[model samples]
Target: MPLGDEPVSFTTMVRGREIRYDRDAINAYLGRLFTLPHGEELCAFQKQLSRGNWDIPLMTRTLLRRNGGFEYSAAQNPLRVLRDEMATFTQLLLLLVLHNIQPCSHT
Candidate 1:
């Protein structure tokens, strides 16, 4: 865990692990994805699915039919979807580490 401005950011003393938040990094990744043609539309659709208001089965079936027979299992799909949603959180920690945003030690 890591300690920082964000309440969600903290450093786990027991494991000496750090966790940080970097919104910029996440936005960058989203920007890259949004730059692709029809990316924004896909993103909106994903958001609807995230809200649990859309039928994932119907969406998956349509995607499979349109984009070949490739299909993701329920278990795999949820995890993948979660990872995508948490991309910002993950990038924040990664950026913190890359920038050496560690707490100072008092000896």
Candidate 2:
């Protein structure tokens, strides 16, 4: 569960499903967020949200990935995470986001 650690394996009960988890995709996202002028924008946006003020325009822009893919929620529960039909990219992103937002586990 450490940062940058990849899942050891994935299992599913169904067949004929496509699941892709490209580590490069995640690294690319982080790289862009850290290296570009957009980082300031991101920080400012997060600050605005933290202040309880909603920015509809910024929310719309934040939902799209750099590759032009739209962001969507993926189930994080172990049972649903094991499903073969889920989009791997969204699942990974959700995991990363949740990790950032959630408190550290004591166990």
lDDT by residue for model 1 (56-107), tens: 6564454333333223577654323332333354547656866676655544
Write one digit per residue (lDDT tens) for candidate 2, span 1-107.
Answer: 33477755433335776443355545565675334374363566687757756543453345433334323457521222232333556557777877876748865
Q: Residue 15 of model 2: what lDDT?
A: 75
Candidate 2 regions with alpha-carbon error over 4 angstroms = 1-50, 64-91, 99-104
> How do all models score by TM-score?
0.23, 0.23
Q: Cα lDDT of all candidates, in order? A: 0.49, 0.49
The alpha-carbon lDDT assigned to residue 97 of candidate 1 equals 68
Screening candidate 2 with a backbone cut-off below 3 angstroms (N, C-alpha, C), the clashing residue pairs are none
lDDT score, candidate 1: 0.49
**What lDDT is reached at residue 30 by model 2?**
64
Q: Give the range where candidate 2 is weakest over 10 consecutive residues by summed lDDT.
A: 76-85
- True lDDT of residue 11, candidate 1: 28
- Model 1 residue runs over 4 Å out of place are 1-7, 10-19, 25-43, 60-107
